[model samples]
Target: MTQDAKIHHHVPDAAPPPPSSRWSHAVEAAGWLYVTGQLPTDPDRPEAALPPGIAEQAELCFANLARILAHAGYGFGDTVFVRIYLKEFARDFRAFNAVYARYFPDDGPLPSRTTVGVAALGRDALAEVDLVCFRQSGG
Candidate 1:
């Protein structure tokens, strides 16, 4: 018998999160939640302004990511894969690692990840992160 799969969309209500011209914010399929790249975006602020630095931006990005995950009924432990895009890899890698380690200490399965250097991102943010998480069945 083929099992039926359910899909869910997670959107936080406090602010209107912008959608990528290419995809939805998050899509769940076959028990897996796929989240789109999240940037340090303050919807209330003007897009021309940039956040202070990599670390601050990373934290905000993660906070946005976490909120999306939560809305989809998942958490950090459910993440099985992560991809990070960095506009200034050489200058920001170290600081990024410091913040990253705090989130995935002990390495434990440590969601397979790929960090790539990029020329730019939406709003010219320094870093952005995208993740995939598996929801525990019946949890």
Candidate 2:
């Protein structure tokens, strides 16, 4: 198959991918969905002010990620990995995890994760998160 036939780009109507030609919100290839890092900006209103606190910012990031996942016909349960970037890692790690735990309950499968300290993120966001999900072909 050609590259176009093997890959699919996902862009939800509610949340346009960042204004750039270089990236998409999510891309599906060989039964895997890779979601780009999502920041705290509101998906419904990208221009609005970002959520102020780490917990709240983390919540928005997950919400944005969820939209991309669902748009590509995947869900949190399908996620196999996650990567988080925090502007204030030492101060906000616990609070960010508190909000993140809600999406991945202890009773259910939890994706492998890697979180790191970053000097900055787009929109001055306190947190940003990305996801990788396995999409069974022919689903």
Q: Which residue segments of model 2 deviate by more than 4 Å?
A: 1-4
Clashing pairs in 2: none
lDDT against the true structure, each candidate: 0.80, 0.84
Model 1, residue 40: displacement in angstroms?
0.8
Candidate 2, residue 8: the lDDT equals 57
Worst 10 residues of 1 by lDDT: 13-22
Highest-scoring model, TM-score:
2
Q: Estimate each model's TM-score.
A: 0.85, 0.89
Candidate no. 2 TM-score: 0.89
Clashes of each: 0, 0
